[model samples]
Target: MASTEFDFIIVGGGLSGLVLATRLTEDPDIKVLVIEAGNDLTSDPRVNVPAMWPQLQGTTSDWSFKTVPQKGMGGRMLEVPQGRMLGGSAALNGLNFVVSSKDNIDAWGADLGNGPGWNWEGLSKAFRKAYSLTTSGNIEKEGPVQVTIPEEDTKWPQVWRETFAGLEYDPTGNDDPFSGKNLGAVMRTRSFAGNAYFAQARSRSNLTLWTTTVVEKLVLEPSSTRVTATGVQYTKDSSETKTVNAGREVILTAGTFGSPKLLELSGIGEADLLKSLNIEPVIDNPHVGENLQNHPVCVLSFETDPANEEGFETLDKLTRQDPATLAAAMDAYSQKQRGPLSKTNCNAMAHVPLPGISTEEGKADLARLLNSTSTAAEKGKTPSAFAKKHEAFVHSILTNPRKASDGPDGRFAPPPSVSGDSGGHFTIGVMLSHPLSRGSCHLANTRGELAIDPNHLGHSLDVEILARHVQFLESVLVKSEPLASHIKTKRCAPRPEMGISDANEAKRFVRETAIGASHYTGTCSMMPRELGGVVDPALRVYGCGNLRVCDASIIPLMPRGNPMATVYGVAERAAEIIIAGL
Candidate 1:
């Protein structure tokens, strides 16, 4: 059995949790314990293999959460799959490495409530501290994660860049997207945290990782004036519960949904809600489970022209589980770690503003959207200080010329469809970077059951913004050459008969088909307490001295891309902050 005490007890062996464990235990005397809810599948082929990520879904490795029916999404319950294994979502994510733009990251300090050292300059250093970028265009030797633009087996990514360039979009040139401009066709990256960060540090004697162990709650020291977390109570394999002591501090890195749910369960949420549930209230912070934000994406798929089969080699056959193709892919990966089975389908992507944000008419339209039916009014309440600050940030991004919305940040060249009958096709994922809508995740009962409500497209402006981006994809992006030459006029989604010819039809289509990107954040916001903050700039929970949150939950503003890179930067910087205090 692992020791019952450590210098630090991390309450989730996910991506951030493991990063913290690895960095903190660099000192032989600093002991760390990571408690995870799932088993250690480090050696699982389904995890190590790149193309096999789709197979991990719905298996024991996935949390497989379903949001409450979102009225804005035609009353549909979207699937939010989180990783339940030791690597967390990194083990199950699509493996597209993208960093946020400087404008968006800087907004966290200038527009939002975050103070100094949270801007792009500060976070970008932390970003490079976690991952080494080694493509033909850019190369950095530092960091544990090996991020690279793989040599693809298809000509689609080149064709994708050329096509976008024809439409007046600039290629990233020699610059990787890390410079923060991020407005061109930069090749998406292939990287994972399981082997890069965790594997190297797991053998450390001072670092203890307990898989299949569920953290029930944080052990709080009772005090009327201040809140302090001293340890955690957890269970292993449905066995009897046990408590572990934290010698210095207790950190919550259980991700967006898990972190806030843990907070509420540990008597640290809204006072009235805890009292009604017959649980003792340690700290009365209503924002612990509020400010939930997620990137909503609508995938537009096109039927690939059968005649262009030579230049447009996609994973259509493999995705359909064709016996021969699967066997060939398995043999190639098992033998040489090269071939179609080695990388994810995503290769080419761009972060652009709403179709015509530079024009005067575009500014007027956005201003009208911002002023009409404010965030609090739409939710049938008065706006809080934080809500207003959030609104201003949205306004700034929408109106700014330099900042792009990550509309269709990702466009996949290979066939992503899993339908048994799904033939050759190309797909583009249109994503809203900074959504104005905010929902929440809270405890459903005293048993620690959760009620997750993403409220996708809850704000009326979200529908308008995302619909405009979708229309741009069908009308302009798909119509361009090089890419258009390969795809047929007929589309798999938004079929020819669907009549998505205008903005109204596009809005309806968005409402019917959009789903969450699973890049959940902002539940435990980092800001001043008066601005509805759960944790302060130092990442310490308000009214608590030793308790802190270091994960996606503490992101006050949503970053512009896949959020994997941003998470790593935040975790790397957090480790430094924790170590400095020690």
Candidate 2:
């Protein structure tokens, strides 16, 4: 409350917030303020080091929000960990700098009516402007984020690419994931916002960042035509409550769960639900917290032969805490900033079209499944404009020969365990890129607690597609050469004795073991207001004049591969949009 006013007030000082602040403050005349709910752990090794990401969850940095029991997963609660620091979830995510497919982004403009700027051609430039590739002999030292594919000494990547190539898929189709498609066992980058965006601009005089401050609600001014956001009411240090005003606009980067929860808390949600919570109603939009989506992943772990260090020397050695290996890795990292510790063991991955889509039998099965699901939706009265449009977008990708619907990512490391029994493992995680299932997030009460229901695997279509992907892996990919020669016949995750007999067994396996990719989006989607969209093409909230959401929550559809690069690209593009308006 130093000046009691600023050009812009950002609710969350996470990834997008920092990017906007850094870019906006480039003009020395403009000032920006960022309020973060969690403290700045920029100096902590858990945030800086690439390998220590798994330990950040359940710590002070993670929000650690648990979803309501998912009926799709047999009434089990899944932990949805969101980063709560200055860098946000980017500080606590698996370092995979992947971009969305071109076809997926193109649909946002063509099918979804998001207009021209939201299309692939427009977004691709934004993606390039955000981060520069810093690989061997191809260094770009300009962009804010330094993205690098850590050099690997093992042959895991070669075997991984060759395995998929053996199945008649091109292993180099997506050598440059920035080209819009992520369809190959290419090595993605390991970069985070902490070491890049925030670190570069933290010392700016025009930018003020307040950590450990929670935003209560937006300060809105009501008029006959529209609602205007002037500022925000917040509690700092869990003590005195205060209000601040914004001179220009107020942006909500509170993330997927937090963004919608704040909107609902501030009375910008369904009128009945707001009134039920003893809160005054401002907007009657019921879609404020709807359209929640996530990429549900089914993991398949296999035991690898450890005798060949050329192919099997993975981070599993680090997981097992081998003293000699640990010492060597530390020495290499500290001395040259290169080693197994420099990046994750999940270096090889592929985003492929639905498994078996080339065969006539597979085409028939897919057609029958799609028709049945469509009929079910019609009978259940679930055919909203948004629903129909989304189904069509997914349909285009699933049936197209070039578009990808399933992502199979390979990890050379074993799952972490405290018993010290995890070792010599290779895991293939098949993630459903475009899930047909939809969910919601809302405030539980007036005091401000969120009831998040990701509703993962709620739709049978998601289950069916994921099951087929798993079946394809066990029957086709793992049995091929190079990769097959490096692994044993035993399974590490689902015991060796647990053999699948048919598609029914695969579906059951998916229902039991599927977990969220932690890439939650679409709570506050960007589409037409009539189509239950919370924001317009300009990313302005429908009923608010100066309020906008610039985080992952604004993503209309779940993108292929990881959403980290897309988030950065969106923020960069958003900064451009906001600046151009001025």
* Residues 382-488, model 1: lDDT tens digits: 13777777777777787876567755643344334435555577888889988988888888898877788888998888888898888888888888888888887
Show pairs that collide, candidate 1.
none
Runs in model 2 deviating more than 4 A are 1-3, 181-190, 307-310, 375-383, 417-419, 495-497
Task: Report every candidate's CA lDDT.
Answer: 0.79, 0.81
Q: Summing lDDT over every window of 10 consecutive residues in candidate 1, give the lowest-scoring window.
A: 181-190
Please report how far candidate 1 places residue 573 from its true position, in Å. 1.1
Alpha-carbon shift of residue 410 in model 2 (angstroms): 1.1
How do the predictions measure up, each by TM-score?
A: 0.94, 0.95
lDDT of 1: 0.79
